[model samples]
Target: MENIRLGGGVLLLVLLAVTSLFVGVIDVTLQNLVDTTSRPQALQTLAESRIPRTLALVLAGSSLAVAGVIMQMLARNRFVEPSTAGTVEAASLGMLLMLLVFPGAPVVVKMLVAALFALVGTALFLRLVRRIPPYSPLLVPLTGIMLGAVIGSLTAFIAYRTNLLQSLGAWRNGDFSLVIAGRYELLWLTFVLAVAAYFAADRFTIAGLGGDVSRNLGLDYDKAMAIGLAIVAAVSAIVVTTVGSIPFLGLVVPNLVSLAIGDNLRRGLPWVALTGALLVLGCDIVGRIIVHPYEIPVGTVFGVLGGAIFLFLLLRRSSRVS
Candidate 1:
């Protein structure tokens, strides 16, 4: 039954991805691919724009969901993710700083800088969580939110002062309209990191039990944490640097997958990835057609959906506790 469901999900994702290829304004079709004359433009659109954008949707979706699950493991809090934990905000700040300081820097340099800041920000959030004598799940995410807000404010103020607010806004909001073949390659790095996370899942799960417990179980808790945070940072940075942040993605997908499959990260990870890709692809497709010639950003569409889901989750949790 489980296998059946998983297979169904994969099929759904494949169909959605196919649907995504044909939904863009340029109107790519199989007929275009078959006909000798129309093949050139259709192939160009698919190769240059549609395919890259679709790949971006899948890569970003799966990787962000994986990163979210890893973060939840490290924090032992379901609500904590890159966005809430200041990781994404810090990464965005790093990119902004790079753009300001070294306007001529390569994308690689900006990505590296953003990853560094993300690592530090994620580390700080974990450290703050550790300081609490007895941690509360609610409090952990709230603290992270506050930390992210502070980092975001600093980033915004810098952009304001430098008169680069427009540039900052572009990188801060998740939008894939501009993605093309050469541009979105960075997200593949994120996919590789997500795959690596699967291998490290057991250690991360043990480590999430807390330092002393994981040590007694013969796991190097610090190493596990470092690996986890590095993955998170790199994933967050790559996404931000390449296509801007997708708010609540890392949060919503993981929580939803966990609710369905339980928090066994290793077992549920693939489903999380598939579901995420399906979701983002579906959302992007909807955004493309919902307004016809003028398309809405996938970020905007998913942000609205994810926000409503988040509120529902929060209220449900509160009610359960009461």
Candidate 2:
């Protein structure tokens, strides 16, 4: 049954990728894709724009998804992803700072700033977790959400002060239309980070057991945590920088995959990556189809559906605990 479910999810994801190629703001169809004798403009658009944008989405989606799973394991909770844990907001703040302080800085410089902020944010969240009482796992995400809200508000204030509210809003809402050949290269960094994550999967699983147990097992708990935080930060900053803030890709993808496969990252990591890419691709396709000429951002679609699912899970867990 589990294998069947995984296989089904993979199939759905592939369908989404294929469908995405067909649907877009422009009138692109199979005829356009197949017509080798078509106008030069059609081929130019596909080769330059659509293909890179779609590939960027697939890469970003998978990277963020795996980052979420690693984060959850390190934090020992299913709900504490980068979005909930303030990493995305922190990265946004960094980007805002870059644009404000050094308006002419390169994209690479901006991304580095964002990565630094995200790493610090992840560190802060972990520090807070260590200080909090361990009895309630529910409080972890709650604390994280509160932290994110506070950071988000700060980001808003800065945007308002700098007179960059519109640009910041675009960044927060996240649109992939900006993705093109030169810009999309940053997203590939997430793929590298994901590969590094696979190598450290066992250590993450061990660290999830608890600091004392991890130490007893001869693993350096703090070092393992730092590594995890670094991975989360790198993956998250790249996603935020490449596309913008995607609210629930990190949270939803990992959780859904974990539901199908077990929690062991070694066993479940590949499926998590596959499922993550699928979900984002499918959502992107839906966004393109629903709005027609003007498209809704993938983040918005995920926000509506993902928020409802997150709420349902929260309520269900509460009921079970009580």
Candidate 3:
């Protein structure tokens, strides 16, 4: 049954990806796919815009999903992921700092700096969570959100003070419109991080059971957490640097997978990846189709749509418990 659900999710993701091919600000007809000379506009749209956007969507989705799974396991809280934990906000701050310090640094250099700060932020988050009593799983996310808000506010203040608000807009809004051959290279880094995530899945699952249980089971709890934090930071950095902050992706996708397939990380990772890809790609497609000539940012769509879904889930869970 788990395999069936997983397979279904994968199928949905593929369908979404294919649908993404058809969706664009410009209308692309079937004849356009066949006759390049006749439909030069369509050909250019598919080759330049749709393809890169689709790649960005898939990479962002899978990376964020996997980051969420690792983060939730490390924190022993389903709701604690990079976005909630201030990792993404910290990365944005790092990029801002790099910009301020260097004045004209390349994107790669900025991304590395952002990634380092993100790691630090995640480590701080884990330390904060450890200090808090774990009885209230809900409090974990609340604390994380508080931490993130603080960081986000600081970022906004800096951007405002530095008069870099326009520069920051690119990172604040998650859009794949800028992705191209040279620019999109960073997203592939997420693929490497995803592979590493799978290798450490067992340790994460053990750690999630609690530090004491993991220690008793002969797993290095601290080491596992450090590794998890690194993965979360790296993944969050890559996604934010590549496509900007995608709010609620890490929170929504993995939790949805957990609902369908228990809490087993190994068993649930694939589904999480697929569902993340599907959700983001589908949202991107919808955003493209809705505005016709202009495109809505994927982050905005996810913010509104994912928020509603999250609220529904919270309500449903509350009712079930009641």
Candidate 4:
């Protein structure tokens, strides 16, 4: 049954990807690809724009989802993700500083700086959460959200003063419209990092059992956490540096999969990845068609949808606890 469902999800993703390819303002159909003269432009569009956009969607979506799984496991909180934990916000700040201080810095430099900030931000969040005296699980997410908001506000204020609000907004509201072959290659790094985390999934799952229990189980809990933070930081940094911040992706996708299939990362990772990719791609398509020539950012659509789901999950958890 799991295999069947996973297979179905992959098929659905392929269909959506095909839809993604042909849904832009400029018409690109099967016939356009076949016609002798039009084929050049059609092929160029597919090669330079549509295909890269689709790949970016999948890579960014899956990376964020997988990062969410790792983060939630390490934090032992279902609601925790990079965006919630100040990782993405920190990355955005790093990118903004990079933009202002060294405007000519290469993308890789910007990404590394962003990753450093993200790592520090995540470490601070985990530290704060740990020090708060064993409390409700809800406090974990609440703390993270608060930390993220603080970082986000600081980033916004900096951008406001520097007259870089437009660039900051672009990063804050992720849109794949400007993604082309060369422009979006950084997102592929996230795929590699996500795969690395998958190989160490058991360590994180064990670590979630708490420090003593994981150590008793022969896992290095602190080491696992450090590695997990790095992975999450790198993934968040790459995504934000490449496309911008995508709100609620890392939070919503993994939690939804866990609710459906249980918290085991090994078993649920595939579903999380697929669902994440699917939701982002579907939202992108909707954003394009919903307004014809004018397009809504994918971040806007997914932010609204994911925000609703986040509220639902929060309320449902609170009700169950009550």
Candidate 5:
């Protein structure tokens, strides 16, 4: 059954990707790639824009979801994700700083700076989590959301003052319309990190068992956590830098996967990755077709859906507790 579902999900993703390639203002078709008689413009759009956008979607969706799983494992809270935990906001701040200081720096440099900020942000969130009593799982996410808001406010203020508010808004609003061959390559770093997370899945699952358990099992609990945070930070930074912020993507996708499967990171990780990609692809497709000729940002679509799902999850948890 699981294999069937996985296969179906992959099939759906492939279909959506193909659909995405041809959905833009200027129509493109697979025939454009093979036929010498086809319009050169179609082939140019496919190679330069559509293909890169599709690849960015896959990389961003999968990596962000995997990052969320790793974060949940490290934080011992299913609700905590890169966006919720202030990592995304921190990365935004880092990018803002980079824009203010080194506006001409290469994309790689911006990503590195953003990632460093994310690491600090994740560390701070973990510190706050440690200080809080773990009586309610909701508390951690609420704290994280608040933390993210504070960071986001700071980023906004700086952007506003610097006359870069529009730039900041563009970065905050996740859209792939601008993605092209040269622009989205930073996301490959996220792909590498996601693969690394798969290999270290066991350590993450053990770490989720808590510090004492991990230490007793001869795992360096702090080291495992540091590595996980670094991975999450890197993924967050790369995705935000490449395609902007997609809210609740990290939070919603992983929880849905965990609810369907279980918290076994190794077993559920691939499903989480696939589901995330599918969800994002579906949302992007809807965003494209809903307005027809115009488009809504994919982040806007996921924000609404993810927020509703998040509310439902919270209510369901509350009901179970009650």
Candidate 6:
């Protein structure tokens, strides 16, 4: 059954990728690909625009979902993710700082700065989690939401003062419409981070068990956590830098996968990636088609759906507790 579901997800992702390639403002058809006259224009659209956008969707979706899994493992809370934990806001602040101070820095430098900020934010979140008593599982995510709100406010204030509020708004709303070949290459770093997570999956699964158990098994608990958090930070930073802040993607995808497949990171990771990619691609397609020639941002679509799912999860948890 699990394998069947996984196979279905991969099939769906392929279908979406193909759909995305041909369903754009500028129509691209197979005939155009072969025709000598229109071949240049069709191929240009495919190579420069559609291909990059699709790749960005896949990389960003998979990376964020995997990051969410790592975060939940390290935090020992299913609700924690990059967006909720203030990582995205921190990365946004870092990008804003880069825009203000270095203004001329390359995209890589901007991403590095954002990653640094995300690391600090994640560390701060973990520190707060440690200080608080885990009386309720819901408390952890609420605290993270509050932390993210604070960071988001600060980011907004900085942007306001710098007269970059409009620019900040654009970055805060994840949109694939602007993606082109050169612009989205930074997301490749996220792909590397995802690969690293796969290799380190066992250590993360053990770490999720708790510090004592991890140490009893001779695993370097702190080192594993550091590595996991680093991956989360890097993924968040790169995705936000390239595609903007995609709300609740990291939150929604992993939790759904965990609910379906159990907490074994090694076994669950691939499903999370496939599901995440499918969800993002599906949302992007819906966004494009819903307005027909005037597209909605993919982030907006996911924000609505993810928020509803998050509410459902919260209510379900509360009901179970009761």
Candidate 4 local lDDT, residue 210: 93
Tens digit of lDDT per residue, candidate 6, span 1-322?
8889888888889999999999889989999988999999999999999999999999888888999989999889988899889888899999999999999998899999999999999999988988777676778888888998999999999899989998788778889999999999888888888889999999999998889999999999999999998999999999888889778888888889878888788999998888888888999999999899999999999999999999998888889888
Kindly list the per-residue Cα lDDT of model 1 for residues 187-297, writing each as its tens digit. Answer: 999889989999998998999898999999999888999999999999999998988888888888988988888988889999888988888888889999989877888
Off by over 4 Å in 2: 1-11, 34-39
Question: After TM-score superposition, what is the CA distance of residue 61 in candidate 3 from its true location, in Å?
Answer: 0.6
TM-score of each: 0.97, 0.94, 0.93, 0.97, 0.97, 0.97
Comparing 3 with 5 on lDDT, the higher-scoring candidate is 5
Clashing pairs in model 1?
none
Off by over 4 Å in 6: none
Window of ten residues with lowest summed lDDT in model 1? 130-139
- Per-residue CA lDDT of model 2 for 1-322, tens digit only, reads 8678778977887777767766776666767657876646566777777888889888988898899999899888888899999888899999999998998999888989999999998888887887778888888998888888999999999999989898778777767877877888988888988999999999999999999999999999999999999999988888887888777777777777777666878878888898788877877878877878778898898888788878877887789889
Steric clash count of candidate 4: 0
- Please give, for residues 44-104, the per-residue lDDT of candidate 5 as tens digits: 8888998999999999999999999898888998788988999999999999999999999
Angstrom error at residue 159, model 1:
0.6
Estimate, for each residue in 182-252, the C-alpha lDDT of model 3 and write its tens digit: 67778888888888888888998998888889999999988988888888888888888788988888888
lDDT score of residue 133 within candidate 6: 78
Q: Rate the local accuracy (lDDT) of all candidates.
A: 0.90, 0.85, 0.84, 0.91, 0.90, 0.90
Q: Against the hidden true structure, what lDDT does model 5 obtain?
A: 0.90
Stretches of model 5 off by over 4 angstroms after superposition? 30-37
Q: In lDDT terms, how accurate is model 6?
A: 0.90
What is candidate 1's CA lDDT for residue 259?
85
Scored by lDDT, model 3 comes in at 0.84
Report the alpha-carbon TM-score of model 2 versus the true structure: 0.94
